[model samples]
Target: MKPRTLAGTCVPLCLLTAALNAAWAQDVPPGVGSESASRAGGNRLDRVELNSRQQSDTELRRKSQVAKQIYGRDELDKYGDTSVADVLKRLPGVNVAGGAPRMRGLGAGYTLILINGDPAPPGFQLDQLNPAQVERIEVTKGPTADKSAQAVAGAINIILKDAPRVSQRDLRLGLGYNVDRPTPSATFTLGEKLGPVSVSVPVSVFEWRSLNESVTERYAKGTDGQPSSITQQGEVLNWGHGFNTAPRISWRRNDDETLNFQGFAQKGQWNNRVRYNNSLPVGMPNPEDDADNKGSWRMLRGNLQYNNRFSDSQSIELKAGIQDARGTFNNLNLRSGLPRVHSVGDNQDRSLTQAGKYSQLLGEDHSLAVGWDLEWRKRDETRTTTLANGQNQLPDFDGEPFGARIERQAFFVQDEWEVSPQWSTYLGLRYERIATSSRGGSESVRNVSSVLTPLWHINYKLDPKGRDMIRASLTRSYKAPDLGALLSRYALNGKYPDSSVTNEELSPDRVGNPLLKPELATGLDIAYEKYMNGGGMFSVGLFHRRITNLIRNAVTLETPSFASAPRWVSRPVNFSRAQTSGLELELKGRANELMPALFDPKTALNLRGSVSFYHSRVDALEGPDNRLDGQQPWSGNLGLDYRFSSMPLLVGGNLNFTPGYTTRQTQGQWLDQSRSRSIDLFAQWIFNPKASMRLSVGNFAPLDGQSVTRLSAGDFTRTERSGRSWVGLGLELKL
Candidate 1:
């Protein structure tokens, strides 16, 4: 699909001029270490700087609130993790549902991500960022008036490193190995100060490979539930590669005004191959099928933003970005030395966004913020199916040439006020409008919707020393149905009747419904926090949500759309109500301080952990249920870190676990999944001031896992087992 005409062409011109003006405004003195730091001296300086920064936790504590957790550079470096997703997994109330991270067990769409307080560009992937580029990460569990009110799960803000005030450059190279192949990565960054302007450019490349295996079992209808068929066995291999580049420029016209510009570009490619062998029941009259499938995808995204600060507490920001992504998938099924089917698909997606925000301090105790944003998205897909020797071609599915266009607009206003010396409050309002149109061959559909939301938050300091605080909030949020799920013109059916078909499945025959409405939610939050000395903190929070118009899949049997066979049709229908509530406890501090008598201060040890207990009740099409579609009941993480005072070494490990939750399909198929656990360990050695190496073990135990799905109608069941594990050793260098 091709996006609308670019609107950012003129924006860069304005920012470029500001950059030039700021550069001419400043008159800086001679370089401090730009000329003196040779390779040897640079190494020494790098070590000292890293150590100094690791000891500072003031930034994290300073920016945190009662319902938020902030992880800074020191926390990020503790485990030698590579991706933002990896670090978030160890945080409280976070779960890796599938390809994306979910907060409080909410779906990916319900969880919002922002870059520097601005909505992230479409198609943005968290794993694309290298830890070196991030200055801090903030996880907000409740709605805040100054930001968008679309988060049903919560919000995550990623703050990138700013341009350095002085001239410096770094080059890093790393090599490692996993279960499948060698992994290699590299990064380079350059920062320079030109008079009154400062600029930084960073580029990185990384690659990884994986090996996985799975086994499946299927049983036919029987009185005793004895297995009538052992369905299939499968093996899979995957490899992925990614590259990224980001450049920033900041210029200060004076103490009262400043301008900054940042640009980002990233590309990634993934490849997967799968092999499966199927078994046939005696005299079943069906041929035994052995299948081989392979797929690959490549994605590209770019974004840019400009910010102008008029004074210490007032500023205006403008941002414009574009995303273009395309990929293809192909599958060929064979049986008895004959090609039974060949299917191929080519898909493309493109999006563009333009946004602006204005903020000013009304006085010492009050401030106001307003913003407007607009976005356009489009997707195009084409599929072809050839049966038996390429001589027979099945007619294109109902929506063969599928295409869609979606446009959305939002405006918001917020006010922050201090009602008293120890009390503060925030009030905000937001309006949103969305329009979408889709077409497939001769069929076309369009829809439009709008909404208004209001929110409020209050905070109180219960102690004069500011060591104890309480927070409460009541807000409104919503989750819009996925564009693809609402506009896709046709149904894509999976290959059935060959393996576990009789055992009942959530048939992949998905077709979009044009009448879907967004799910609306009213939420409440309350929390108390105790700030300890040495930047430590202990907190407990409670949250609740009441949601309506819940969207879920509804299946129908014997649909004419697919030759009188069962169809897993997805129609957005409203549900009565769903309620969710959860409790969170977080503790982070030095062990010596928490338990002075049990630990020695000389050990230099710290502890960090969180526990979350949550549950939800929803009226499903099948019946009453206690779980929302993607949410888990409970989750937790624990980690311990020790810094050796005698040497430049740091070692840490973490354990994250979640108990599996089960659910029922609209068609009466029940799915039960087993618990999941992940363990990671890391050891880092700062060999020189500029050089370091890390050894990491991820999913170290190779834990066995299983899941079962049962169909009451057919009295059939299917089970699958798999394992995940890997290890890596990496080296870092700076210049």
Candidate 2:
């Protein structure tokens, strides 16, 4: 079915289901068929039945006071995914773009990513982390006082594996196919308890390769008002290998206090080669181009946490962390009838963090928490560009080291109150200040910003059992400008020579603005959630955000201090105000319960799906297509899993779709992206409880091609690019 028609049908159906469930929930007695009741009777029962991963995950979501979703081991191991990005793409209202996860169709920087409740380090790649190292994933739809208030769309927290009470060991081996070669990957996890200490370590090694093809066409008016056109065909080959490990240790000091240490390390290298052939209409010789790029990065971080419970109603926790990361990159480009250009760069980053939180219980219905967070980070980088003859490309900036420092401090207080058995509320206030300083050559720039944010959330149980509920939140969130955007530096366009004065709008030189301010937002969210029997759930949510000081790059022709002549330069600026709103619907349940007439009542079949619609407008830009950059109009996914009754086998598949959309970046510039569709399938053969094999196909269908177009008064340029897919086979062991 068409995406529009499907969206129209699904929204109404989801709302209807929520209404029916709410009505039915009122008649059911409190705790009649709840998980707590099933485990009642002094914690002793005639028979014990362990909850499945799905059931446990559902319960966690149902119990959360705020709107959140929990994905446990079941999701991590569902398709034998080697990367966390692959696993995240199937989540509801979430999508992966440029190796980063976007929430609610918003682009990167909108979703705040956290590791073990702490903000992830800069330059961290989610695709490099193995899913086997994760214990669970938590997705919160709004900002909370305990966490950083940088989430303008939402937050996703990656909880690494923790020490286990019982000794455990597991290993996984996999082989993947992409392009014309086969790649191998492996992961191993070990956990043990010794005396008063518990330790767990998970390590993974993986390799990947892909080849993408593209065709570019450009049309522009020459000096004589005649249109000149050029077509270029290009190919890029990329390959990489990486390894990462997360080790955790817990030391239990009696029943009232505990200490923990967690360490994470990752190292990786990637190489790519590019070649392009130009086809001109006039048979004129075009610049022959060939480029090679290589890069490597490494990170090491460690954290220590301490917890103390002075009394039953009071507790305190303290944490300290340190991180060091380094990277190196080199690139070489060769052009016909031109000098060969070679560039190399090195980067190093270091950070220190300290945080503390204290909680107190007020009477029996209210819990209050106060916390403080402090962090300091510094980055040092050096780059040199030279010709094959050993002459510096840019004399003023060559071989010079530049650096930036960021310091952040925050204080927050929150209270959670159980007003009554049927209602709960959260009230929080936070004050955060960020200071940044950048130095390049003889110029130094410093910026400081502070914000005070207030957040409120409330939940109402439709029935006494809490099977059906309503959640609403009013929050103030902000997106801070990154170090790169705040740095005052000049980066010349590679397509044209540095000494050339002529430049095109599509290939403009880039520069940063040290005066850019953070984007602040006021958000409202409302959701209705209904939990059904047998690990089923249905939720419909609506969200709206009013944003001020939106940051966007503005292009203009100018001659700066570093430039000798006028050139097109794109610099970051605080654009006009913008607003966005969306509707999200999610439904997951057993086929027998959701559609009894279409399937057998006892069939072991499960179904899950989600659809989201979004709309946005920038007040500074004129219509017809003045939406937010990279935000699609609609997106959805459908998935199913079936277990064979007569065999030890399970099969599942998922289909994801996002329609094409256009964005009017400026009055004279436009960008368009093609529709995207992906299909993934997996089959598992269970030999026993401890061993299994899985065969999976990711992006089974041909990859979707994308196109981008830039328009001017009499000039236009368009580029079309193709994609690739992969397949894998994996063996999992529990010993």
Candidate 3:
């Protein structure tokens, strides 16, 4: 969340920027030389060790059979002031407005979240996760057929680290505080080696607060492309806490195979407060729609797997998992303390997935990999509210209102074939079967669906370890209708012509229409990467794709016969098609200290940056006027880092720059002034092996960072999103 006080926001932002400019002053991995480094490999019984880069959290999350995804992590500190939303914004193709994370330049409804490889979005998902305990984050940077049948843009997967190992007992504590927020966290790992048996378990607790002051709007429409928004300014705060625990037990059954079992549990909760004052008439001077948002979720999961090495050239592993989750949302709309307004709702979800993968070593120049995936899921929800005393709040369009339920199942498989020492090829296929039903609740629509897909990838190595190489892929994918599409109430403008009632059940709406085909996509991509001997790398790529059955929202009107309600119609319809393609380039590496290039073992310099340019054209938009959508025509980030390890303590800083781009700015929902660009800076110091500190500042001058919008007489514009500058400080200890 953005800070509240003017000084609080400006002061820290400046400090951070300054730090970034003077970076190249810090340290590297702790204890790499003195501490014993375990050799990476598996024991005869399948016990394995992973190197730092191989087990990176970033790559893990992006691993959907296909579709590219990315992520970033915020280092923990003594001043534990970290926001999940804030960290998410530093990632690619992700931005948050009004506390909602938009992925692939799309809305919330399109992206999906997963927990430890499971498809699940628990309440407090964004607010309550403990950043300190996150081992790493990953993204699927490509496309795959077996990934999903419903992923319109693509897929994202998050893999949590396996339980830590313990010999006796160990405890970890972290505490941090910024002028505006505080963080408290604890973690403990325990383990013991008994004869031939080894057991390990890790537990963590985290709590933090997020607060921001501002006003935001959802969407703005029309040809001019303005933003949509109005001032109902206020202060908001969120307090979140959560924990995770998992245990691992393993036995060396034999020389050829090993068995392992894991039990895990996770829980999170967050409370939010939003107060706004809208401008209006006396009776509605400012609608006081204060809401107390409280959410909680719980999960119990287990994993069992067996590994077998039949020979030196091949190996196979079989694994299965089971999970159960229930979520609760108690939302109350109010117009003051007088009476509860219009909404009270609750939801619950459950799912299970199982699969098996195999790897075969074919001589010294080749290898093969293949796998199959399967999953099933169900959900339920209940909503209760009062409209105008006598009118009912909801019952979906078909007239049922208790809740909604659904079942989805999918299966997929693929193979990776290595053709030679420098070349590799991949191919895959996936299929899904889905059935859904609803009654009395917003999710009530019964529909059945299925999809088939084929995908492939080819890689060439120009240099060793894939340092200089090119990769190309072709993929076909699809997305099915979600809950909102089949269940919303379709309507017409109440103004004049044919202003009539339009129920979602109307034939044109396809409420229960099972004939609706899935959204399909075809894409071609080419990428090249090169390693610069100086510890950095450069990469560039180009891609193009076509999408059919794309769902979109458009305005529909009748001849002054519509009902006395709202005008616009919001539903799922496969209107026009979309063609998108772009160019991406990235350069990152350690700065050289020697070639006037100051390079040293004690103090090191690093440079990292990426740029993206996309050309999107709309051929068949349902709207009368045809034009391109407004995302960014060109955007990217560049950072420079400096670190010094010579002192008893280590210090370093980094600067990040992102130039702004303009869209056809709209009004109302997304009104805002044009911001040319933005930048942030930071510096960090390690007091010792066990202690560290960080300072961050953002948006100095020329900072037309537009995050706030305003509504004028008719044309809407916006104030700079970021103020002059803001500063933040943090500290951390490993004891």
Candidate 4:
């Protein structure tokens, strides 16, 4: 538990280290047959993770944060964040890649989101996650057969704070600003502990406006044609707002029985307006066409879990939850005298997910644990577009759009066995039955099938020094296509019109075979950790994964366009192979916590952080030799903070830099032209244990025209990083 005036690193280093060391010395790190006596602090902070160990685990350059591996809690509290994407960007080895992210070469459909390790409803976009209620985020990299057969892209577990153990309570309020936008954001949270039960509720709201401007020059035809058009520039305005709320409850009825639950709900919306204040080509609108779009998304989630004891060495556990998601986006583009185009998008998802987990202590020397999970979900999505007299984005275009739906059901179970005091092994299996259903008079489609997944893990302790240990795991995984990818079609006027969308007879864009096989990957990961006799810590590891049936949307340029259809268009195709590989390293330690009381107030402070280095390659692609856009190869995060018992205030910050890395090169070079190096800096000051403030600046080292900017005016669509620029401010509060 946090003190009235919080101070010290997030975790209790000394105690956690001792607990683990004691267990390691006895050949029982974590499993059955291990003594049940609590050795030290394991659970305390609500928004941070603590190792509890002082020696620290040094196996790779990448040190898992206080939260879970992959995804963690530090993202939310490190700064008062408003969007989920903003928080995910700071994670190591992860690059936003502009729109979203392609984890280990896996697409969005393969990645699944869970609140407290339970599957969320379908149709939910990653960008819509609410940051306010998140206590921490754990990313389970690589395949997991039981959690979600669809976890080929990895798993994101969002851990919400359970009610505190005290009857007392705490609250927080915050606001932030951006130069180009006048949007104001605020957050409030209250936590209370009442004997055997605890509860916490948090609410947040934000309203913002932004401006976007761009300039482009017309390049003549192949023969250095006549002077085409002078430099052209356009301006856009965007407005957006969002709402989020979370409620958590925890009950520890005595010591042997306990219950924990966390629920979240959110609503987000954005409006975009564009104005090309310039002239058009031949027979185009004078002041150029104008377009506006309105979009909104809402999500609701709940998690419930309970544990009880029947006797001294006997116990049972059960956990269950559900998630509902729905959203709509509308875009209208047209000019005064040109044919109008109207595009609307909508999606609704409902799911009933539950699981039964059990653990039984079998005798004094042997124990066994097993669990089962069940999930059923469905989603409906539709996109429509038509051409009127004039469209804001385009002048002439006539077409109608379509809709589609997908339904799925999955079940999984696993068991852990204690081979002996010096070693343990885990083995598990899971199965999923995916049924994709389609509607709207568009040839109903269905993918009714089942797949089997398996996993294995082993651990060993080589020495009593508690420094030498080895862990390894092998998991088989699968990725299923969503309803949108297989059966959804929208009339993208200029991009894809009647020529763009048609009957499934022809493979659609961004998808391989309508009956495409699930992508497969086998992961092999082994790591070793050791604590030096004296001080420092170091970790390094190597990783590689191969993916198959990679999906990509290919342009059908030479393929003649339908007479009544538009000019150019595209469709989906299967790319034979896609591979990803990389190496990682992380090192940290207390250079010296006690330096003979250097200052007046108290003992000397401690300092430390980690550095990661890696490279990624698309390996193979069947597309028109396009550059993997918006991806950086060499990127790293370095943080150094100090706590003071002397001064009334503390100062600290982190520096993150990413050298420009183009995953792949595009044909026209739009991505390459905008490609360049960029870095961000952040610093915080704690006036007292009760109040603190921080400033985060991105593109702080921006040069020329390389900075961060939202291209879609009000939406999250970022065109590219702009020139040297920054945004900063301060925060203050009292517990």
- Among these predictions, the greatest lDDT belongs to 2
- Quote each prediction's TM-score: 0.85, 0.91, 0.73, 0.75
Evaluation by lDDT, superior candidate among 2 and 3: 2
Best by TM-score: 2
Write model 4 residue lDDT over 1-735, tens digit each, in one string.
Answer: 111111121122233345435534554322223233211211121002222233222322123211124334434655545556666665544445433544433345555666666665654444544465676666655555447766664666666665655543344443333334335566667778777788888776767555555653332211132223333455566688887777888888878998988777888888988765444442321222467779998888787888898788767778777778888888776565344567776777777666765666666544455566665666666555555633322222122223444444555555555566546566667766666555443345555666777776665656644455565667667666655556434233332333433312122223223454566666665656444543444445455556566555554434332234323334454544555445555544443432324532222233344444443344453343232333344456565444432222233455555554333322222232334444544444443345555555544444433322221112111233234333434354545
Question: Clashes in each model (backbone N, CA, C under 3 Å)?
Answer: 0, 0, 99, 44
The per-residue C-alpha lDDT of model 2 at residue 383 equals 82
Q: lDDT, candidate 2, residue 315?
A: 98
Question: Model 1, 359: alpha-carbon shift in Å?
Answer: 2.2
* Best-first order by TM-score: 2, 1, 4, 3
Residue range with the least summed lDDT across 10 consecutive positions in model 1: 1-10
Per-residue lDDT of model 2, residues 424-502, tens digit only: 9999999999988888889898889998999999999999888999999999999988776766667777665454455
Model 3, global lDDT: 0.51
Overall lDDT per candidate, in order of appearance = 0.68, 0.84, 0.51, 0.51
> Candidate 3 lDDT, tens digit per residue, 1-735?
344445565555476556534532444443334322311111111111111232232233222223343333322221232445445554555555555554444445444555455444333255344444444444444545445544444444554444443364545555433335546767666777776577877687877665545543322332123333344555566677888776777877678888778766778877887766554222211223566678777877777877888898788877677776666655555455543444445555555667666777767645566666665555555544444363444333222333333455555566766676677777777766666655543333566766667778877888646557787878776656554344333322111112233322111221222234566777787877665443345668787768777665433423222244334443446666777677877765445522334554323445556777666544563322122334455556655545433322223333334444443222222222344444555556544546655665544342434543322234332332323344456554544
